[model samples]
Target: MTADTAVLPTLLTALRLPSIARNWKRIAEIADRDDWPAARLLATLLEIEVADRTSRRIQRHRDQSGLPAGKTFATFDFNVATGVRKNHLLALGTGDGWIETGDNLLIFGESGTGKSHAVAAIGDALIDAGRRVLFTRTTDMVQRLQSARRDLALAATLDKLDKYDLIILDDLSYVRKDQAETSVLFELISHRYERHSIAITANQPFSAWGDVFPDPAMTVASIDRLVHHATIIEMNGESYRKRVAVARVKGKDSASDN
Candidate 1:
């Protein structure tokens, strides 16, 4: 083995990605030959492969259909993000954190904020850490009940809900709830209450949840169980869409100079 290449294999072994390590050898050959264009080409390939791997990992553990795909614990807004209490959110992520070990997480904010993304990211993180997770929009959850009741195996489906360590309910106000949907939702929450944690993202204020359930009494009961042992994250900021627009404009201007 050449002196220069000998040390490279050892380092790549430490990285734990054999394919990446092999790619490194090809990239090194390009660099040694002063083949600048070939080096750039190899670097680009390496970047694409790494990115693809990262995407696969995120998608594997994430509920891509139910919530925003990009939401992640790492990308979650922690700066302007405000929630229950800093210490509490910290604990939620830690093994002993209040929300850490499958305790409920409630994120309440206006539309276009990062509520759904934040919860989804948490669920993704939990999945990667060997916990089972499920994500569903409130509307989809209600529709599932509509199907289950018709099929006569609602109990079995409800049992499936309990199988997950964490469940995410996003867009809680997508449709108005009837007595049947409300009852089923309550049952699921009651069953999971304290036994497992739920992460809920909502565009409506908690006070206005009645519009979904329609029954004042049932709404309060549901909230009591879900929030009693939960952490409430209140996101306050401009629309995330608006923030993106501004950033894109800035980027476009910078690119025009080049």
Candidate 2:
């Protein structure tokens, strides 16, 4: 290799061009073999670096998103979720359009009705579209915020969370009406109100949400904030898992009869 070639990696590193540093040599060989002009070679090299950097950033965001890697829209069974508006959900899932407006998504359904799956699918889509998202169970996130509050670091934690464009809080019905925990959750909601986006999945309707928050007034306030600018999706149908289980049982029974 020439002295110039030997120094390319060091210069790329010094210039903080990681992708270019790793692949420039190999790409240069192709460029030289094709007798490419200097401008074309530079453009191609920079383009690869740009694309590679974007891919890496997406992967990093995906890793931090708390969403299951494989839970994508393609894997979801939209046929089972008839009440959900596929196009509307898809438009929201594309990232930042609704979130930029600080709107919320309130997903309502019974257990096993694919509510969590649907939210995760949307989160997966958003993350792939170069948006940051965080998925957490309602109780878990509350507990985290509660701990932060105890440590007097609640503000810092909330500040850190502001980096995410969307926060998916699953199973809103499961959190107990404990003051300490619910207060933190309420604070989170109030803090993010009209500022950022949140997608929540719940097994109960609004009329029953008072049971989830201790103070009746707090419950009303929470619901008001969440619903004020929210797109509510109701999946009121038989559980998908139950139907699949029943079908399997019927299939086994028919086989035995045969």
Candidate 3:
């Protein structure tokens, strides 16, 4: 091979075009066989590089997002959660104006009502749309922030979370009502208010949020910030899990009869 040909791989590496480096030779062979022009070859390689980079970026985000697998819209039961419209959910999944402007998402539902699953599905969609998202149980995230506060690194911890376009705090009501826990939780809501976005799933209504926040004033403030520019999704219905469990029992009984 000529020195020019031998140096092509190194040049591609230096340019950080791994996709082109890996696929260029095969594409070039095709190009030659097809009698393609130089411009067509370059364009094909560049397009491949761009597409590969985008795919890798999306995968990386998905891996880091902490979203539960199989919770996508396709796997979700839209019929069961009739309160949430499919079109609205699909629009939210696109991460259009809401994610870009740092608007919050509030999902209120009882246990087994598919709040977590819906938010997780939405989170997965946001990741696919090239938005960074973090899905954490409310208590888990609170403990993390509490530890940070204890270590005097609360600000740094919150700043690190800024990298995510939306942070989904599943089961927000699970966090025990305490000074330290609720304080940090309030801080997170306050810090991200309007500047960043948060998606919360809670089983309680705004009136009952005092049970979570301890102090009525803090509860009001938290609710205000979260609701100010938020899309509220109420998923009030029979528990999806209970329905599935009942179906399984009936199936077992029918099998026994057979």
Clash number for every model?
Answer: 3, 0, 0
Candidate 1 local distance difference test against the native: 0.72
Score residue 65 of candidate 2 by CA lDDT. 85
Ranked candidates, highest TM-score first: 3, 2, 1
Q: Give me the candidate number with maximum TM-score.
A: 3
What stretches of model 2 exceed 4 Å from their correct place? none
Location of the lowest summed lDDT over 10 successive residues in candidate 2? 176-185
Candidate 3 has an lDDT of: 0.91
For residues 50-101, could you state the per-residue lDDT of candidate 2 as single tens digits?
Answer: 9998999998998888896677789888887867878877887886558887
The C-alpha RMSD in Å for every predicted model, in order, reads 10.0, 1.7, 1.3
Q: Supply the TM-score for candidate 3.
A: 0.96
Runs in model 1 with CA error above 4 Å?
Answer: 1-68, 80-91, 99-102, 178-180, 250-258
- Candidates 1 and 2: which is better by lDDT? 2
lDDT of 3 by residue, 1-258 (tens): 779879999999898989998998899999989999999999999999999999999999999999998999999999889579999999999999898888999999889999999999999988889999999998899889989998999999999999999999999887768646668999999999888899999998888888788688998999999999999989988999899999999999999999
Q: Find the candidate with the highest lDDT and give its number.
A: 3
What C-alpha root-mean-square deviation, in Å, does candidate 1 show against the real structure?
10.0
True-structure Cα RMSD, model 3: 1.3
Residue 147, model 3, lDDT: 97
Q: What clash count does candidate 3 reach?
A: 0
